[model samples]
Each structure stands twice: as C-alpha cells, then as structure tokens.
Target: MSGQDPVSSPARTDSWSSKIDTSVAHPARRYDYWLGGKDNFAADRESGDAVAAAFPTVRTSAIENRRFLRRAVAYLAREAGLRQFLDVGTGIPTADNTHQVAQAIAPQSRIVYVDNDPIVLMHARALLTSTPEGATAYLDADLRDPGRILGDPQLARTIDLSRPVGLMLVAILHFVKDADDPYGAVSRLVSAMPSGSYLTITHATNDHMPPEILAAVGDADAQIPFQFRSREEFGRFLDGMDLVPPGIVSVAEWRAENEAGPRPSAAETAVYGAVARIP
Candidate 1:
C-alpha cells in the first residue's frame, strides 16, 4: 500500500459525515468486525458474534473469501494484463487490497473503488494509496445505482472506459434482494465495460450447508437482510460472459494455491467464487 494519506479534497467531506448512522449495524462494518478490524461499532460486533455463533466457520469463510479476492486480482493483473479495475462494493481496507495487488504486479494499473457505507467512506483514505506510476480513487456509491457509477466523472478520469477493466463484485451482490433487480444492475455494469473486461464475483451460498445450519444463519442474518443464493442462481450473475477455468466453485476450491496449503471443505467455506470474461 502507498504511504500517502487519502486525498484531502474538500469535496469528499460534503454531506458524507452527516449521512453516517453508527446506531445501525451495517454489512460493511459487520464484515470488518468479522475480519478482526477495529472500525466497527458495538451493534456490528453483536451482530457479528451472533452470526459467528450460528455458523462456526463464518470467520473462516470470510478469510477464504478474502484470499479468493487476492488470487483473482493477481490473475487479472499478471495473467490477463488488465491495467484498469472498477471494484464495486469495496469493503473496509485490509491486507493486499485490489490496488496493492494490481499495482504490485503492474505499477501502471489504475483502480477505482465504490461503496455506500459511511464508515467505508471515512476509511476510504486507507484504500486510496496509489503507486507513483498508477492511481486510485474511492467513490461513495451504491451497487443498485449502476448508472450513477458509470457516469461518475472521477471514475471516468481514473479509468479509461475504452480499455479492459477488472470489474470486482466480491461478496456484495447477496445484499441486493430480488426486488432490487440485482441481475439488471449487474448487466448494466457489465454493459458499460468493454469486451475484454473481466468480472470476478464471490457470493455466499446455502447449497452445501445443512438445513439446520441454513436456518441458524437465516436467524442470525435477520437483523440485516442477506439473500443467500443457490449455486445455480449465483451462476446466473455471470450470464452472457464466459467463465474462466474452474468456473463457479466454492471459494477455497477456485484455483487452490499451494501457498494457502490444505483447503477447507465446501461446506465450511459456504461461499461460491468465480472469474469470467466478457466475450
């Protein structure tokens, strides 16, 4: 990660701080709490604890999902030769962020991160680190508003729309219920990218878990709505795109690396991940 602090532009502080509601438990904060991050509130911790109690492997699943993200980004940067990235639903910053992984392999890589959480916006500086050769920017936007994201001038300035981009939707689509037209939202985002662009997704699934476990998870997630999709349903998100090798498998099973050592069972991971290319 670059040592520079977040951009200190006055535009970032306009109305963003007032929109923060710490009283409610947000998915991003709850995710940070699960990853042992300090940028979470008491409500987030309580919700995270409840979810962990219901699903003992929730933390493991989170860790494995993060590993999947690193692997996917490295592949896009090193193998696919992608120089631009649009990472929507970017959670709180952690080790090997998208820009870090991409810039490490290709210093000229430019990345733009999008998220709607107020806490995430506050911590956006941690994610804005850019290499001297590359650039990074954070946008406070929701996933449902693909048009707004596609039209954002900052995104346009950082990433060239004509070139191939790595569109990362990791662990975020599940939050968009069916009523919100998640499929349409994804298609709209994909449509904005060029032919060579790549889409990497990791979504929670209820496929491998037992009924009792699913019920418990459902109860725990009652505080905040989380729609766990089936494997087939999750696969639909990649429609019209050609999946990369080892298509749409459990998070731990996708390109299992020797560095990560032994892999966990699909039931334990409980998340499906894949990388697909626009044809």
Candidate 2:
C-alpha cells in the first residue's frame, strides 16, 4: 500500500457492513477527508464540502483538533512521563498520530487505538506502526461502549492500568449527543482508569459561532446534526479531573506553540480543547 491510497484489506473486501450505506455521510470518513486522508467515499467528500461551505471554520477546527492531539500526547509522554495511551474514537491514521507523537518523545510509549469504522480500522492496522521498543493495536469499538474498551482483554496486553495512561477523545464526544449522556460516558471511562492518568478532549461548540453559520450547518446535514454546546456545558465533562494550566479553552488557545492571539471572530471559532489529570 502506497502513501496516498486507502489501505487495502486482505480477503475482507466485503468486511464493511452493507448497511454502512456509503451513499450517506459519516462523521469519521468526513473527518478523515478533512485531515487529508484517503479513506472517505465521494458522498463523504460532498457532505464535508457542504459543511465547510456553510461553516467556513470546519476545516480549521479539524486541523486545530489534530494539533491539540499532538500537543497533548507530547505533554503526556514528556512532562507527565506517561508510557501508555488509550485513544478512543481514533480517526483515520494521519500525520503525528498518538503513537507517533508519543513514541517520538518516548520510544517505549505503548498505545492502543479504538474505533468502530471499518475503513479507519483497516488504515489503522496499515499505518499505526509502532516503534521497535513500543507496541500498538487497533480495536473495532465505539466511544459509547467504554466498558467494552476498558474491559477488553486485548487492552491489557499493551497497557498497564496501574500505570498512568493518556485517554484522548479528540473531536469525538460532540458526535455523542446529550441523550447518550456524554458526561456519564466520560466519567465511566475516567473512573475505570487509575489515578495520575490524563484525560484530553477537544469538542465543537456554538458558544463561539454566529447564528447564521449554525443555521447553515443545520441545513447542510440533517442526518447528523452538528450539535454545538456552550462553554459551561463543555467544561462539565472535566468536572472531577484536575485541569492542567490554561484550563478549558479554545483549541487554538490550549498550549499553542504560538502566542495566544486574539480570539477568533464568533463565526471562526467553534472548537474547544483541554487536558486534565485524574487525581
């Protein structure tokens, strides 16, 4: 498999569920395309383009989310001196992935990626390469099933829950609507892990977006409403965790390599990111 082509599967040409219905749009594939990955179908591209047209900040928000993941992983591996990571909702493999960024800082860093998307799982196996001293694995699971993720025997093979681990949910929880009780899901996952572990997240919000842009996005994709929450709602996800310096803020404002510039205009800033530790 070359760099640009989507990773091919061995005898699993029919692996994807027929009900996957590539005719409609999906959050993972659309996000993969936004991150310059090749795992998305034409329908996903079309829908993503429509969303970008409506909300011009979608592309920037996607990129900023990726950057936040890189920065958070670096902090866990370096400053926090963590060696294990459990990245849920792991998207299509892209540059500076969790394993890559973490192992770059500490080659012994071990990481496990979990995602329910077949295309992402295929790419993950192909591209989520681990260092000689590290380990990596991909599990086909959804964020809604944190129990399945935490209790999976395979997870124990690479990560030691007794030790500190980084739990990354970059740009994923927003897709989990309120009825899903995203807060409870997050709490369960964090509670299952041990003390000193870190929880890093990035989410989309309407708190910093204009009404016109929000309305346009609403019409662009009716199937998956891009539900945006307020800053206070986003903060509730980190209630029990020890928030790191800078606390919960916009993705561009969270330990950015560059200086914290003026906040983006309401229409341009729709993403928020933060890191916290379980104590």
Single out the weakest 10-residue window by summed lDDT for candidate 1.
1-10
Q: What is the per-residue lDDT of model 2 for residues 133-180, given as tens digits with 9 covering 90 to 100?
A: 888877777888889988887688779999888999988888888888
Which pairs, if any, clash in model 2?
Answer: none
Ten contiguous residues with the weakest lDDT in model 2:
1-10
Candidate 2's C-alpha lDDT?
0.81
lDDT of 2 at 114: 86
> Which residues of candidate 2, in runs, are more than 4 Å off?
1-9, 12-14, 17-20, 259-267
Candidate closest to the true structure, highest lDDT: 1
TM agreement with the true structure for every prediction: 0.95, 0.91
Clash counts for all predictions: 0, 0
